[model samples]
Target chain A: MSYKLQFAELLPYWNVLLQGLIFTIVLTVVSTVAGIAVGTAGASARTFGPVWLGRIVAVYVELIRNTPFIVQLFFIFFGLPALGLKLSETTAAFLAMVINLGAYSTEIIRAGIEAVPKGHIEAGLSLAMTKWEVLRRIVLNQAFRKIYPALSSQIIIVMLGSAVVSQISAEDLTYAANFVASRNFRNFEVYLLAALAYLVLAMLTRSLLRALGRVIFKAR
Target chain B: MLQFSFWDILSNLLIATQWTIVLSLIAFVCGGIVGLALLFMRTSRIPALEWFTKVYIEFFQGTPLLMQLFLFFFGIALFGFEVSPWTAATLALTFWTSAFLTEVWRGCVESIPKGQWEASSSLALSYIEQMRYVILPQASRIAVAPTVGFSVQVIKGTALASIIGFVELTKAGTMLNNATFRPFLVYSLVALIYFCLCFPLSWWAKKIEGRLNVAR
Candidate 1:
């Protein structure tokens, strides 16, 4: 089979590329927020909650971490309907992203939690702070500051992971590239462009997270 | 409702796990060799090689493995080579794993104290001899915990192979779930098997890291 180079053909799809980038950014932000929330709860549960609750949360994180997100996506998309709980494909994808992100983030955040000195916790308690307040005002703040870099790295991973949403056909960047490449018959160039776009996006995410850490953790 | 005989799935999950193991091994073996080359290239004096290595690391580390899988499965087909699902998945996962491993190893190597290199130089060891005898022996210790930690990622990564119709545990679960019309049961079983596979390794990695902390 002979091939044709069509770099010019891809130029017209700039809007789609932009939309794909926005879609990816939106998914990453949503998942990052949701994942952090879930992870914090999971971490708390494992550390301070009732024994049964901690066990359950531990099991949840490990199961999610061990399995592939694609499988979890299919399970939500295809499996849940049989149980009469139908969700939009986007909703299912979003949920899968949150769950997947939560597991990895739990590990990262938990490391931060552990790194907080025991004396810090005692100092907060001695200052008359409630258990919850101490965990919030001292332990977690310090922990987050310390693990911010790893957390940012994980967020970048999740940002690119948004591409997997295409399995359910969420129309993210990679999905759009597949469409453009198939239509233009310039698969190699289209994918190369897509990869470059992703590389740029990842770097941008890293720099943005670094800046955010600087602003939020000014004590550092 | 998606339902099937429970026992049948047990056997299929077991069998499919073998494919997952096989895929992980292929990717690791191939990725290890490629990763070593990338680490060397990144450490080399050649500017072109250094730029190439950075571009490669950024490219792979930036993108999602799913996209990489899709790009490889479909992209390579456009190069006039008909590709099987296994061929596509192996190529993609191996490519992705190498970049991360290279960086991990590079960090381990760099973490070696500068004095060790200096001492080797003072002893009249050539650069190659220094690396083989002094630098590497030390770096290898630093690399252990992280290497084991990364294998968890490599193991989980094999599950993506299922997307291209490579029937690993995840793919098997999907197929079984579809035919049996039992998503929760099937995938729960799928998740359990993976937990069993991964938890031991996770515990081992943590143990090593704990020991490394003590040693340091």
Candidate 2:
């Protein structure tokens, strides 16, 4: 089987790919920030909030963690409309990703939060810090430092998982590949390029997140 | 007008779930075999094989399963063979599963103390015999919980197979949602079914993991 690679066939479609890549990056950025916020908040609730709230958070984490992200995406994108809520494809994609990442990172950050010793909290309390202040300044800072590596990896995982958003026609990188391939009949070439793009994106995101961690946490 | 009651949507979903389970088992079993091979090569002290395995893992883990599925589904056809959705989905998922399981098991093997290998080598045990008698027995015990945990991932991964036109649970949900125009009910039921299948396995994995930690 002699198949020639025709990357040249894709030159006319560079702008399309760029648009898709931008969408992908934007989705990743928005979801990562919002997801981590939800995760951190849920972690604190599980760790320090009322028992019933903890149970509710536990249920949310379990339900999200156990199911497939595509199912969740479809549920939100298609199902929510039935309940009188209509969301754009991009909005649904964003919501699904945030919800998905939030659940997984809840477990990850909760582990970090649990690693904080009781004495640290006690110290913060003894220093005349309010409970909210102690959790924000002391517990959260230490927790983020302890779990940044795992959290960053989870973020990368979510970025990779974002390829499924194209399934709902959000026009992300994978959707661009589909568009170009269908037009040019270069399925193999198109997907290969898109996969490389994703590889580079994953590596770039990991390094960026690492650097961000260094800047924020200020490693001694 | 075509009609699907609650039970109709549910029973159809239950039937499609069979495909999901089957696809997951194929991936897990096939991937376990390939992953075990990769693990041996990775730990065999051979530089070329070790590097190759590492790159293989990174490539799979770094990219999304959806793209991999698309590639294999279309890529294999370039090699002058017909590519069925079943074969494509299974191949992509197997490779993906092998990469992750290899890494997981490699960690388990590496966690074993250095003395075990030395003791076995001093006794003139062949590498295979050493692995069989001294190394793998210990490592397999450590591997059980995580391997089961990874099964949940495999099950979830099968959902991506739907994009390639495999009639799995997620695909079934979409079809039902279209037919009944009851997206909320159909999808919620689908998520619940997945929850039932996966939550127990995840719980078991954590329970065993906790016990293993205590034992250690």
Candidate 3:
């Protein structure tokens, strides 16, 4: 092979790469929080809300789950403008990630919620807790404990999937690699670095999530 | 300027959908073969092979598929070989799918009782013999539903091939949208087509999973 790896050529673009890495982390963190919140709410509604509402949530989950993330991003970024709901590239990417993770986490959290025994809710209610309190204190707490590992995995998946955001010019880590590759014409080196960065990010995200889970679940 | 009727868009997308299906099948089949090899290495008693398989799965699972696609797409070209997007996408998706499938299948294999391995070895069966005759047969039963479930992911993974300039469903949708300036309609149809292709498989996986749980 005549081609030599030119990773050293990428050194000048370290700041660009750093900015992209930070942006990607920012995207992952924001989307993870908002997505899990949406998931928890959706799960609660499905488990306790009216039949019609449950059906609506089910349809939302199925539609999101069945299609690929890039399609959904395209629909939001390019398609939504037709409906007079134009958003900035970053906003569109963030929205897409939140919506995508929201759907999957809704299903994951729902599984946890359903596994919560009826006796636990009854016990909380008998202790003079309101329905909201029972759900918040007993149902969700136990459900989160049961599904924390699955939920954590989903969060990491979403973080990794955030690479697609670069397609819409959202300037995530993959975008940094693309930008640097275009500048230096070192596509292989740039992508290799970016991939390694992503591997590290995924590991960090996993560990952070595990620490957060430990803190939240307490006494685990 | 050329005009596109709704039927025209649908028909074009339908044509492109065939490539998506073909590409997915290739990736899944090739990945399954490689993943099976990895699964054996994972289950093998040799520390070196097991450790290598573990790192392989971790690297593939941890990195983004888009990045992997880019690596394959560009990495091959750098080696003084003329690389087509088809080869790149196929190779990337295959490795990506193999990583995930190996992990999924590993869980199923591990879920088999330890006593089965002990009893098989007590019968003087070789590792290959045990896996081929006894272990795989049982693990595969538990593996079927999840394997089918992962195919939805394989289909979805192929969409990233569009980014590398493979003219599959998503790429076709982009071209049509550019031509027609009807992003909402084109992308919606694109998403609908994917849902159609994927929903049935997921439904079947779920149904099989439910039956498995009931059986257990």
Candidate 4:
């Protein structure tokens, strides 16, 4: 009971922690963009592509969604090197995040696409719009609007899940915390600080995504 | 050099899988009880209790489950308790699971019309009586599908426990990979085993959800 919290012990390592935080943010941003692009393409393929293509996407989604992200990270980081496809820890981590988020967002976006009324697409088609134009102008805008909130939540989940990338020495925020904790032997304080940082990051990411949504949708 | 046959690896992993299942069940059951308590506090119409529950949920939901595990793993040692990874994993996953389940169940409870509550109260039923007799029954029917769905999350969350040196399936996979030096084969098997454990639950949840939607 006499153990006093020594958060100040971690102060000297603030630069390291800050670097990790920025790296994590970079990871989140890059993964969010790439992941959503992949998801959109996957969703479109599932909804509009050939039967074989749709089945391929379905299998990919199911395989990723059912397994844990950490396992996926391990598979990419460790398993792939055996196949002569070696990647840096950071690249592997980023790939895992993108693939993980892509699967979840694919499902979310697919639901939104399916929710778009058939009548609306037909209306767009009758307006002299080609299939691609109708899908781009009419289908996706509304679908993204419907699923933006869920998509935002999944993005944040991926951001938080990025903590595990440290297990492979990716040197993200959690890795920084572990480094500091090891140096100072203040495991409790360092982890407490890191957890609070993550809480703040999650909140900030949530609001930022909300603001982005408002700008994109422009519908209240 | 010790050679581990494929069966040797598979048999060891299957054993470790039991701990993963056990840990998940403990987290789900304990978290359910705690989450139900939080659900009541959140909906109890008391401002302070409601606010406290809100902060509790926000803290757990906002942070990573891995951070929570580290906190529990190292945080307990500060209290002079010789904490095993099992206890830390259980405590951390329980709190994490409770936060999510409370949110899920809160939606279910709130979806019940206010008229149900008013009607129960008008019949001279107490708050607990109303919840027990009327609200929970209705809410639980809607809650079942999502609750089952969330169990997959609980199971996956246990994978992080491996990082803290818990001898669960993921940890065993890592150990076996080191022993066998076949990361591709080992991790693939690990992921496949998890998929086998989880996919059925995910499918069942979707099926139940579909049935509920049809019933509605």
**What are the runs in model 2 whose C-alpha is more than 4 Å off?**
none
In model 2, residue pairs whose N, Cα or C atoms come closer than 3 Å (at least 3 residues apart or on different chains), thus clashing, are: none
Q: Lowest summed lDDT over 10 consecutive residues: which window, candidate 3 chain B?
A: B74-83
| Complex DockQ per candidate | 0.57, 0.89, 0.91, 0.90
TM-score quality measure for candidate 4: 0.99
True A-B contacts kept by model 4: 0.88
Write model 2 residue lDDT over A1-220, tens digit each, in one string. Answer: 7888888999999999999999999999999999999999999999999999999999999999999999999999988888889999999999999999999999999999999999999999999999999999999989989999999999999999999999889999999999998899999999999999999999999899988988998956
Q: Candidate 4, B124: how far from true, in Å?
A: 2.0
The regions of model 1 sitting more than 4 angstroms off are A182-184, B1-4
lDDT of 3 at B183: 99
- Check candidate 4 and list the clashing pairs: none
lDDT of 4 at B51: 98
lDDT of 3 by residue, B80-167 (tens): 8888999999999999999999999999999999999999999999999999999999999999999999999999999999999999
Q: Quantify how close model 4 is to the true structure by its C-alpha RMSD in Å.
A: 0.9
Comparison by TM-score, 2 against 3, better one: 3
Tell me the tens digit of each residue's lDDT in model 1 across B1-216. Answer: 644568988898999999998999899889989998888888765899999999889889987787788778877787799999999999998999999999999998899888998898999998778878988788889888888878888988888888778989988987887688678788778877887888788888889999989976
TM-score of chain B of 3: 0.99
Candidates arranged by lDDT, highest first: 3, 4, 2, 1
After superposition, candidate 4 runs with Cα above 4 Å error: none
Cα TM-score per model:
0.93, 0.98, 0.99, 0.99
